[model samples]
Target: MVAALLAAVSVAADPATTASAGEQGAWFSDPVVVSGQNTAEPGIEVAPDGRLYVNAPAGLLADLPGAASFLWRSDDGGATWVLTPPGLRAAFPGGGDSDVAVDPQGATVYFSDLWVGSSTAAVSDDRGNSWFASPLSGVVIHDRQWLATSGGGVVYLAYNQIPAGVMVSKSVDGGRTFVVHSLAASVLDRSGCVCPPGTMVVEEGTGPAGLADRVGVVYATSTGGVGFARSVDGGLTFAQVTVAPARDGIDTTRAFPVVANAGPGQLVAVWQEVVEGQRTRVQFSGSADWGRSWSDPQVVVDAGTPLFPWVDANGGGKVGVSLYHTDQATLPDAAPDDAVWFERYLESLDGGQTFSPLVTVDPTPVKTGPICTQGAACAQDRELLDFQAVAIDTDGLALLTWARSIDNVADTEIRFARQLTDEATTAAPTLHLHDAVGDAITRPLPWLFRTATWSPTGR
Candidate 1:
């Protein structure tokens, strides 16, 4: 143990801290924003020690630059971060899109990187300290999904570059190699985009507390309908299940799914579905026997237009979820349909059989400026916005990080709300943090694709 340390430094609340005493959901005191670096891509992870470790991409990190273009770790968790000696950036010269993953035991860490213009992989052994770059034999240009590692094993999600199908690969003897397999094994091309085969998409992880496939599921949309597939053999193979069965010739796209494996065979999955000209709904489905069958789809958000369905790793045998939506109807892609919406930062207290709606993740008065539909020019809009990650504070309190930024620069400050809610039951529906916070996070960091993990396995 390094004895958990923080050097002596001056501390004061920056005046930009906003406090709302009258709002129904505001319980923020004097919260502070921890400023970050400009170059490294920032993402937070909770270590086995129950502290936050923030991974930042290459270039002599402000604190630490463990590996190459990859990420670093923080012993004091996110409170204080550092860079290790050998890094992920040094390992993968073909670096492109990089993602972080922790072992099932939480004792090891993994960094997954993509090759530029393609779907190649390079991974880290340590928590970002060092890594090895291995060519994933047959894989061409697939996208990176949630990365998982257990002891020397490695698993990942990827989509076909053409037909837009889903695929997953695994390296049983660590990330040195892989066994590739196609998921959602359906033959569906794009919606008339004369492209080659299409690729699949993946999501963040829910650790061991999450469902069978962890947090990765493959959904394919075709002239037929949208179908679902999940991997249990560490992503080496997948079994299909229909998420949105064919009804209207309408198709399903962007079906983000997350699961929680309650027990040996009990699993639960949730995803979002859109009806072209109608509403998008978030629904929950469960299976008591490992992917053998699923429960009747329960519409979690039936009254509103759902946009996203995200899940968090709930500590005590549960999973947390965030649902984003709007009730005020607007024509598809219409103007100013914008509104500060509410969400249920829910937790499956009984492992998916029940839920508790917690406080709103996104703050009130709106988080960021309206969506910029101007395409390429939208990235140029620098504006003050809100952004934060969820942290488990106490037994009943969840820490929601809230901050503001403008022009991708720090215009305001960051603040967090300590949500005091009942952990035993489903919390109430609250707001989600979707109003594009800072342009910085969404900004592209081409140089960061090479960083790795920083734990002991880097050796």
Candidate 2:
């Protein structure tokens, strides 16, 4: 006997919010302050139980002592947040960038930073209540250290391998020990230093039997292009694939690639670049059957110069990309004036075939200025060190987070906005029924069936 009760969902445009549905289907929320105490290079993640975690460089030059990092947690989603107690201080005296990730169960949280001579991490197993610090076993992590945790507690850390290539350190037993895997490109040019952080996603290992669990990482190579590396047997070894060919305008300021696993064997990656004769724009491509192949690149956002594009995907083929955009000059021209910079977003409900309209995320305007550090390069770039982040909750809400320089760069604050659209509303898990085995079953449609293997007797 099969009996299921699922709520009927509908679609309508929400006019009061920027996440309104239109020609391309969009949903954007108002900006809210996660923290006002000088946050930089923010990283955001959502727990399985609806908790939100954000970590970043705590403050500017005047906020603290000995290069500190800040941790913030929200029990009520992103509606509110509080700074985690006992902040982490750098083992060394310098700070460049940091990233954070939570275990699949949300029982453990990990934060990474450049230590005295290598990349180190601060771990909290008690849901950010406390912490302990340690190095990444044997590898030397560069300035931008990124962290990602698999459902089975495998921790993967990716960073630049000095002169060339990207190295990933994997730990199967909750980061106790690591096996480093190198993914070097033959065309890696070291003459110019441009090492962007590599973004990784652990494939959902719930597919058919005999399918090797995969972990994918995407980053920009020294050549002005994006490279993808996949590991089939955990993180022991990796095979590389070029998502986009090398171009002429691949600089640290313009080339940031973000990647995500949409579903079983479905992967998507996005990055920003300038063609030799075209304007700067964001290009996207994906692979339905893992990284064995990928679709051609297509422009997703090109209103102005879309800087630092970041992408994230959910289990149901929903992908989100966020970036700091500016309406500057096109390629082959001098750097355009640093006009007002704003945050923008793009989403694809059906993998990478189509995307929603270019939606403006933050309503506030950000102004850039010359670097205040004496003797620094004469580049008038905005202080956005890294890229923004987008994470989808189980309920299909997209939470976009970033550090916005407000009040004329005098104080940078961590900010975020929530976006919800008709697609998300219809996909909401409003009603769930249990099967004969007492496992919760969520049926989006009468014909679409999904199962959770839970035992009522005991584990």
Q: Largest lDDT belongs to which candidate? A: 2
TM-score of 1: 0.62
Error of 2 at 364 (Å): 0.8
Candidate 1 yields a Cα-based lDDT of 0.40
C-alpha TM-score for every candidate: 0.62, 0.76
Candidate 2 residues 1-459, lDDT tens each?
000001111111121222321222224545668888765567788776667888776433223234547778888667678888644434422244567788876578877655424555667787778766665443663545577877555677777666455667766666655655555332243224345456777764543321355777776665666777777766667777877776675442344577776766777788767655455677787877677666666666655556667887766767788876655544413443455566777676656544554566776654443222111242434455556788877766567888777665446888877764332223332224333345554433311112222111111
Q: Candidate 2, TM-score vs. the true structure?
A: 0.76
Q: Which run of 10 residues does model 2 get worst, by summed lDDT? A: 1-10
